[model samples]
Target: MAVPEDWMGAPPRQPVDLHTDRPHAARVYDVLLGGKTNYPADREAAEQTLAALPNAGAIARQNRAFMQRAARHLVSEAGIRQFLDIGTGIPTSPNLHEIVQATAPQARVVYADNDPIVLAHSRALHTSHPHGRTAYIQADLCRPGEILRNPALREVSDNFEAKGSHVNARSKGEVLRFFHGLDLVDPGLTVVHRWRPDTVEVGAAGWSDADIPLYAGLGRTS
Candidate 1:
């Protein structure tokens, strides 16, 4: 089914700029999840990585489930109405906005990523419920102050960081520093699998708690 012009938002303010020959983390992740948004180089890189780590695909799925669980926790338990999700890869089903808005239709979400491919597909992520809102920012996380000060994040009450991001091989303490001033929620900075796993959502990629590759933390600005 084609999305009619009237249903879509305004065109992206900037043209999509990307290098198809280079393998990018965002695109590789898309390929791992069986998405068609990636280039041949991304698929090739993903295949090579999977060949090296046979469970790579499964771990990727688990990571995505972890994201959904975090969003669910924020909406159901924390009563958070706004969210800022960094390192947001290609928009996948049950995205942060989808998961949160399903329960709290007025939830507002901002997704930020440095990848050009992610920017290209950000339009899909911009769609929100009639009562909710969502936005995307193309940004590099190295500048923490920038993300914290971005206009889009001004209304964010809760900031969620899915740790163990490939670029982040830092010690746990170093990673926790990112949320220093904020108050952490229950099960603070724990492994993804340990954060109130929703079995129904994890499906076949339900790897052991110890096997989850990423760490997830939620913090409030209070």
Candidate 2:
């Protein structure tokens, strides 16, 4: 069944429904990260947001970095081999799977998102280490019960809930509601930049508590 060495391993590509006219959150984030997978509408919306909040772009990038660091912590420190990443955005390099698999190649990840565009480009997420596995689900969180009952989400062992959708301010009590039943890991629910900061430059950047509007806490359901 082996093909000749001169043969190309993969087949040709086909057309996918990108819906170039509409703007999706994942695509809009891709545009902010300077990725090329976005459409004109996404760019326009991003530009408008940027015009209103000059710090918006920086916030997005900072959030992305925090996500990576948090995933790495889960794998390296917490020894989590399973991940259920809801609201999973467009596949960027060193994605959640990539980061976790780096330390634990047997890690399994299920990325769920509501965006059709994310579903279209999900093939990238399928690439897992030979010892690991990855899957994607197209579902909306509007139906929280359905998401909770999903087979993929049920497979996750190490649980964490940190979402990027909140651009508005949230009180600490509101944030603690997310971890009502679960036990929080050390350094519970703080600004993204302050979470186990690696270097003095980042930890001492003089970023105010209000500079970042997002709250993230790592918790376990045990």
Candidate 3:
């Protein structure tokens, strides 16, 4: 017997409990992103979410766009050359590295995620530029100490660590708390589509907070 072609390159390392019977947030997100890496359960969950929020898919895309815009700004304007992305879900195109490294090929990025499935698909995250580098660590976001201690993340600078989080949603006050010890760049914690909103596209001119309920901000250690 032979496996179907669609089943190729689908298994993760070490055979962790995927729980395909249930919907995983990451996979549901993947589904919303129009990626085929999700299961039936994940699609059903995504549909439910869509039903509740008709623009959920648009919000997802805008959320990713916000990260790209922020990363580009950090690289082109802020002179940031190192990055640490937490909760990096499935391999999405024009990833953080792809965005930053495009402007500064010497930029280094370390993606951290606790999902075993993400670990299995980590290979896609490693296509760093020859001048730069990218690494992935299978770690939980709740354990900041462990991630900070990981050698893969510490190689660039033991004293310097730039963290980026791609979360679903957060209240204005709750989101501000993340930058407690850092000085926020101008126009802090605003709606995602409002941040920059540079790229011209259909309906881009009229995107309101109600259209995309995601927030983005940049902070620097003082």
TM-score of each: 0.75, 0.78, 0.81
Error of 3 at 76 (Å): 0.9
Candidate 3 stretches with Cα past 4 Å from truth are: 1-13, 16-22, 156-158, 162-170
| Better structure of 2 and 3 per lDDT | 3
Error of model 3, residue 47, in angstroms: 1.7
List model 2 lDDT by residue over 87-141, tens digit each.
Answer: 8888877788899999999998878888767866876545878888776666787
What lDDT does model 3 reach? Answer: 0.79
Q: Lowest lDDT 10-mer window, candidate 3? A: 4-13
- Top-down lDDT ranking: 3, 1, 2
Instruction: Give me the displacement of residue 217 in model 1, in angstroms.
Output: 3.4
Error of 3 at 69 (Å): 0.6
User: For candidate 3, lDDT tens digit of each residue in 116-155?
Assistant: 7776566544588999987777888877878898877776
Best by lDDT: 3
RMSD of each: 5.9, 6.6, 6.1
Point out the higher-scoring one by TM-score: 1 or 3: 3
lDDT of 2 at 157: 40
Which number leads on TM-score?
A: 3
Candidate 1 wrong stretches, greater than 4 Å: 1-12, 152-184, 200-210
